[model samples]
Target chain A: MDDKLMLMIPGPTPVPERVLQAMAKHPIGHRSADFSAIFAEVTENLKWLHQTKNDLLILAGSGTAAMEAGIINFLSTGDKVLVGTNGKFGERWGKVCAAYNLDVQYITAEWGKPLDPNEFKQALEADTAKDIKAVIITHSETSTGVINDLPTINQYIKAHGALSIVDTVTSLGACSVPIDEWGLDVVASGSQKGYMIPPGLGFVSVSEKAWKAYETANLPKFYFDLGPYRKNAAKNTTPFTPAINLIFALHAALGMMKQEGLETLFARHDRLRSATRAAVKAMGLPLFGPDECASPAVTAVMPTGVEAEKIRSIMRKKFDIALAGGQDSLKGKIFRIGHLGFVTDRDLLTAIAALEATLQELGHTGATPGAGVAAAGEVLNR
Target chain B: MDDKLMLMIPGPTPVPERVLQAMAKHPIGHRSADFSAIFAEVTENLKWLHQTKNDLLILAGSGTAAMEAGIINFLSTGDKVLVGTNGKFGERWGKVCAAYNLDVQYITAEWGKPLDPNEFKQALEADTAKDIKAVIITHSETSTGVINDLPTINQYIKAHGALSIVDTVTSLGACSVPIDEWGLDVVASGSQKGYMIPPGLGFVSVSEKAWKAYETANLPKFYFDLGPYRKNAAKNTTPFTPAINLIFALHAALGMMKQEGLETLFARHDRLRSATRAAVKAMGLPLFGPDECASPAVTAVMPTGVEAEKIRSIMRKKFDIALAGGQDSLKGKIFRIGHLGFVTDRDLLTAIAALEATLQELGHTGATPGAGVAAAGEVLNR
Candidate 1:
């Protein structure tokens, strides 16, 4: 009833009405002939979106589940994994690995900063015996709104003979992530972010190299057994019963994505990111991440002397616009606005206007109310 | 655009319009104040729906994932578990346990039959050393439409000092399952079944005994960690980025269930099931399971010499209805019609009528068009 509620979080972007209708339809047979057609179409579209020819499998879980699947499926217990830790999701990889009793080596960059490709090369070179089985990194760290140089780093890992697992949860469709070209062994993604569908389905594009690790690796797994999933997926069915509604929704969203074209979608996100950053700069808010590595999905703004929580709360309660505040050590320090999937320039303008009003209410001001929208409009119109 | 499509499969039932709209809303902050409110409300309702005051945690995964979480969280590699295998899902539970390297012993019932309570008692009594850490059973076997007697079986497990894990994926909301009173240590459910939502979210309610086993579990788990999930859930947040859109839809569906009251919902399912059985009998079709053990969620019919696949295909193409064919060896011999979640008397009558036409076209049957509707309406009206 309240269409005014605007979500500017990192994911679960608003779905189109058509996609919702498709999902809302009566549940189909997960193993039926009709669903097989739909399943094949979705798989083809997913590979197209990822720019890969690898066997893409869908899991009826969150993006984190796919990430965990990548970990346990590729590495045995006590196996060493090189984790790139710059933001929340990267740290999660390390923590999950540690929890699973893996020997974890964590490489760090400051929060809101991207990891260097040369540093990655150094880490791999340091492991002369090739103890490190995989290098795990996030393409877009939603927490800090930073996009690392995945292509270069993945190349480094490939050259050193270590597998690369990339978390493309936030950047898959919004940016050009060429999975095959980047030599990523396993790329994990969720439906809610760039796919413009409801959350519930996660996908992993597994390279032949990753599949090789899967055969000999010894770790506990059942529901996410990539082996059975790949085997059954050839017939367009899951090893287990899937979230059938979400699959229907995925089919619809993929169709829409195909119609829009991936290149055009990436360009749209690019323009949106540029406009949002320009507006933030126009409002005199310092950007959280380095300019060269800012994420296209979300923008993190560091408002001087202003508590991010207060601004987020006011925008949410007063204008029904939900913005994300910082997590962990950065809480109440930086606020983030998402302009990802299904997000248009008009939505960005709406968020900017709400942010402006909320900022003024919180007693921080450097620009007029209309200046943010106008600056963003300049890029959007072009 | 075709609103008349009937869902007679076990899961991914027809979602309500309100729930669909809720899911279509843009993704919200996973940890924001508003998202917390939603998470809190969904948990509260789920607790009531599960009929337990235990620690109920939500995972952004399918029912199998929740089952895996229950297994790996409580059992070690060499631990012994008693799995009751009657149909597909039960065998799946055993396979997953085996994959986890657990020593599993099976007490199997023939397909279309419930597990004998005495069988479980004998198994436990035979193991005087209490080597069996847990006993797993499916409350309602989706593959066979058999509802096992849980309360008596759980009592047997309790007397033997072993915990009980029940898969109530298909029966949680369709029938009355007094989880805490029945001593169910862990109850796993999915959204696509009786919860009246789409697939993707799996819920597990853990008892004190199960929580105690968690302290000693040495298996590999990270994203499905109940410890972190329980701790973060106290603050109404998930440890990882949640499937936000599905949660929104779940909240809406749960709200609708609460308004109707659980007891009434259960009773309605029971009546509809009775009428459906009467209709099948009147058509001279033999039911798959025993009358006393038939699940309220769905009815599996053995249509004599008629082909299940052909009946299913005719129903889908001509009547726009989807019926579930049998799995494994029973395939093409039996068909299932689901009456769980969001089904009304009118829906049942419509499905039955279409089934009659399809069955007759396939050169089988002895019933008039209105006989099934009449049988169902009599019970509903009473």
Candidate 2:
């Protein structure tokens, strides 16, 4: 009967009980005025979370769909674009752009390293013809636990007179990402990461500059068309039949976030991230990303002696805990501890305790029995 | 506490309580073994429901996205395609194809009229060079209660040496659609319509011939790419982070459908559609579409003396019943009564009674107070 597993992945984080209950309510007609009011309220709250007065549209898909919409809606075929890649998600943006026959100029950094703004600046400066239409960046690279310096990179994009498109999938609500203040032209995010809801809805905030670009952009789009979305959003509705139950869940989850307040929520995520990092360091494991730019949403740890998959398997089989393993090239080298969305300090302590037990069972007993929990507790107290 | 509204729309249909409870469970990691098992089970059940051994991939979006996927995956730019349009969803397919720069040859029919297979044959025979690459049709036009004859049209397509793409959004679980036997190349459907789940997930079944076409098709795609989906589906996973909670809900809903059996499910829908049509006739309202080609999922009624919107308003405001209004050119002229998915005879009777009373309130005194319900009951008894 004890089949409950704690989800600690980066995107599909733990959903609150209230939010789940809201989703379980009876289905409502998407065209009804009642549903339109609920949609309007959720849209306004999402704008508040993004700190943007720009147009925010809700799409029914993963974050990748939102990212694709941002690209296809504002750029035409054969248009030159600059893409910065330091992790898996960043590389995905480059691939999406390339899929539409866009001339992509990629500035890639090694995994686990923060993206340098100077690289983008140099690329932008080299475009003497001013042919580059947009500059794309990822705010939080979930694969390697590095938070790119969006503020600096966006400034370079602005100086070069190119539109700024940012992927805030893992950082929208987990930290302070002011889209308006940063002058981000198009920012895309997902629901399951920081909205404390299940995965279905993707969101995008569009600036006035991006909308103007959309008028001339002709890269072939239908389902992900922003024009229809913009027209319907003014009436508090979506162009297509949206994920209605997910929208209900989002309304409830956004209310909970409003009650907790954005400042308090960001501080809470920061505290949990600090505790997770402290616990990992105390366990004698090396952190993957740089100490200065660690992501508040998830912490990546490099297990020295044991394979990361083995540790994850042991944790799941023994303690019913689900942790995300490294993706792509970093597969057996690193494991991630996600503290995003509805995570608490106690949950982090429990995960750390499970990690300690799992490490001991693997015959890698460098740290004390309760060292990880103790370190996390010290950080919580501070 | 008495705010429970019955959803009678063609989509976002009434979700079963069991499916809702399944969706209320905590989120799971998309890459974990637990999710893979659920996903594999759901995929197999979907294949059974589709009556096809073809590769069926689930995308996280509305049915429109699946329709777009069917077009963009199997045809390149400027490819000639024949589109059959009788209603809103059919025209949507033509619009989607045109958006991608396809040379669309549309065979148009009046609203509420069934699409003629002879027209398609004529169109195909005229293309002496066999230039047409695909033939697209909507199996169930939700905007009008007309189920186009797909089996016959697909035969014409096969004889013409062209691929056939079908949109069965509101027909898959409501009636029999043997994709393999019908020789359908691509079939797309949505979750909310007949899967007894909420909106979000879109399913597309691709035949082997379509796979061959995909190798040479040059249309642009990223998030809706079927290549990665086929590669990852072999391992019981999706290419991107799917709508995890909706997949869980679909798993439970498909199990319920399996228990009910396809024969019984089709009979149930048939019975509901018959009773609904009888009730509307008893209430002195004319049916919109031809009686022989009426959809088993929903029934469209044409009011004689009163406006359709007035009746829908009265039903909603007084009885807390939400009926679907007409779309596009049929607005305020026809109201649809949906009996798809988890609907029952009792629900149909209640809706009929509400309609009768609303008609009386609107000063239409031709029918008795309980005439609609009585007629429906007699049909159910037979």
Q: Per-residue lDDT tens digits of candidate 2, residues A1-382? A: 2557998879799999999999999889999999999999999999999999999999999999999998899999999999999999999999999899999988999999999989988988888789999999999999999999999988889999999988999999999999898889999999999999999999999999999999999999999999999899999999999999999999999999999999999999999988999888889889998778999999999988878989999988889888889899998899998899999888988999999999999988667878999999999999
Off by over 4 Å in 1: A365-382, B1-3, B365-382
Chain B only, TM-score of each candidate: 0.98, 0.98
- The residue pairs in collision within model 1 are A12-B27, A14-B26
Best by DockQ: 2
Every model: Cα RMSD to truth: 2.4, 1.1
Give the per-residue lDDT digits (tens) of candidate 1, residues B313-346: 8988898888888889898889999999999888
Specify the highest-lDDT model's number: 2
